[model samples]
Target: MSDQTSMISARGLRKSFVQRSRKGPGIEFEAVRGIDVDVRRGVAFGFLGPNGAGKSSTMRMICCVSPVSGGELRIFGLDPATHGPEIRSRIGVCPQEDTLDNELNVWENLYVYGRYFGLPRDVVRDRIDELLDFVQLTEKAQAKVDDLSGGMKRRLTIARSLINKPEILILDEPTTGLDPQARHVIWDRLFRLKQQGVTLVLTTHYMDEAEQLADRLVVMDKGVIVAEGSPRELIEQYSTREVAEIRFGVGENEALAPKVEDLAERVEVLPDRLLLYTDDGERALQDVLGRGLRPETTLVRRATLEDVFLRLTGRSLAD
Candidate 1:
């Protein structure tokens, strides 16, 4: 896409960390190798990867918290190296770790944070009320941070991030430790933000979260981008329509791989189960049964972004 239409753009972007060796000279650890990324305005974009996959490094550079080691990087069509303050003023960030002051009440936390951005007291107060209501934390506005539940704290953090009315919102693992219900709540709020024309850039390891929030995403592995596309597009390009999960007895799955390899288009042998990738998982399961192999359990499900990740990286997303 053209630069004029892209809110964030990168070409051959790279980040490295200098690590000192115990017995030798320092070594450079490449956290983000050469990669290109483009985030259009008013769209939710994601960086998906497992631990130590350069997702966080890329995000740091984007946020201007970490300097780029090499290559081109731009936010709002301006160079981060020179326009860090200008860019930061227009973006809001919800970090992975909760940084709220435990001694302060929820509303106070938001009010204080807004003050840091040089907002007027009346404006900050008004915005705090609106944000607390938006995140469904209106009832907890006067509650101390220590009294809030995990989900409530997360909601407060999201609300605080919006105090500035930023054009772009950057979330790092927004729902990392929340329960399913809590995660869905956060997702709904984020969906609303996107509908209101806020550009969202997030980093996540959860395949479902990426699929649910991102219109387009890039899958990163070992400091490099392995694939980039929408959830459905990546799944269609890298995996089959369906996946057949067959679980045998412990230690029995490995031996059965060869016998059932020809039944599906592709076979993935895990420690406890075998995944058969094919157009029709029910048909594949029938073929396996016809071959006289009785599995302990069988499940047929549609392909997911997790399946595409496995196909491209030959490793599970959780790994």
Candidate 2:
């Protein structure tokens, strides 16, 4: 059963594809295993995972662009299988790639997309104006798509997605390939959208991006959800209150790891550094010093979402 208050609901949701080999029988590959998810309305929800973790497959199913192999998925309390068109009309999608038309000017691209929704010429024109202004692209309305910068093109694609004034907006890797300044600009725009009561659905590999944007998030791995919670809750649950990062030149981490094992609750040995997870990073560092171990450098900081990911999956988000 679907939750009416939720924008999206999935129960035992699964997706699979057939892989055919020239030398053998076709094999079935499961991209998404049985999983349950509920995205409440009027909140930003995020999906975080490493590559091939089935994030894209799940997003495609929610957008109704790909059919679910099994289980139930509902959008706005409507079955996507029978109400795909109705569901799509009420949602906007900003894909991973900026699929803008290079032949068209900024305004024309949005105009063409609005027309696809069967919106009236007058309404489309009015919508284009509002969207361009909202995305801070009004000044570039007549600029050729080929002449725009990467950030501009991304913002334009976001504007085009909003031509229908959708109630739900789905963004896939929204700020990838953008500079820090440009990424912050896009983040501001998304923040405004969420404040306006449009539910946001996002997938990102950037831990900081997930922390900043997602009110609630799920961490997926090997086609299944490993954990779910708000950023702070997840950090508190999976990580210590603080982390001490220590560096001791090259090829020294492995040897030093065991030496510092008793300093913190847990110790992780990386290629070039060591992470000590404990409630008091400063105390851990002092313990290390008292043991006559001299680290080249040390940093103590509060635990972040990245720490949570490392603790849960034993892999970096980029992996």
Candidate 3:
């Protein structure tokens, strides 16, 4: 069994799929380019990127569902290629999309899944009760899977993955479609799991979710990891401690962009305004106006992870 120390490790892990088009041409699709990752035990690690960023493919390789085409991969110190079943048996997985058995009631869903792992009926029953409470689904214990809301379905998926009491839990965009209340509830449960020393690995397109939950993470684009570190470390290294925003009063944002270019370590010009990243945002603000550049408004504030991603990738993460 893996202990509480780097349960997941990889070196140059890679996967590619070949696709043939209807136009009569075949091409190779590299879903996950060569990448390295290490997820330590008892902490939440996230893969942050927009859609089609290979986050899902990289996750599959770590979970051992998709065999890697190149390089090394180990979950719990066992090679995924050869120890697939053993590794899987010791890990919990909540996939990107819900795959519950619609025919099963909430309780039966848990019971049936537990039986798949060969758990004794009595053990399954006891664990089912506990899990229902963990996810706050006890009140709807007998509801059919088809009858649950989007949030309830997600919570049930999380509960089902834990039935085996796996050493590691992997969640791929687990709360994508939930309401804000439901999302908060899920976040609270995840925080409790982390506090209890459960190792978690998750992928998400939501920057706020990544910032709120991840202890350490990797930011990916295209098919490779562009940056990796704790959330705060990344912001400090790639961006300034603070930023000054200046909106154009009449002229274009670029008209004032050159004025603040060297006032900060970096300056990014957008359609409506310009951003100056520096240690002292006030100083940068004074410098911009002192240069005779006129603007509608100026706002100074602390740096955020969103700024770091934008500077590194040359575009907003969502767009």
- For lDDT, the strongest prediction is 1
By lDDT, the candidates rank as 1, 2, 3
Clashes per model (N, Cα, C within 3 A):
0, 0, 0
Q: Write candidate 1's Cα lDDT for 57-162 as tens digits.
A: 8888888889999999999998999999888888998988999999999999999999999999999999998999999989888999999989889899999989
lDDT value, candidate 3, whole model: 0.88
Provide the lDDT at 262 for model 2.
88
Total clashing pairs in model 1:
0
> Candidate 3: where is the Cα deviation over 4 Å?
1-4, 22-25, 249-251, 286-298
The positional error of residue 261 in candidate 2, measured at the CA in angstroms, is: 0.8
User: Which stretches in model 1 have alpha-carbon errors above 4 Å?
Assistant: 1-4, 21-23
Collision pairs in model 1: none
User: What TM-score would every model get versus the actual structure?
Assistant: 0.97, 0.96, 0.90
Give the C-alpha lDDT of model 2.
Answer: 0.91
lDDT of each candidate versus the true structure: 0.93, 0.91, 0.88
- Candidate 3: tens digits of C-alpha lDDT, residues 201-267: 9999887888888999999888799999999999989998999998986558887677678899888
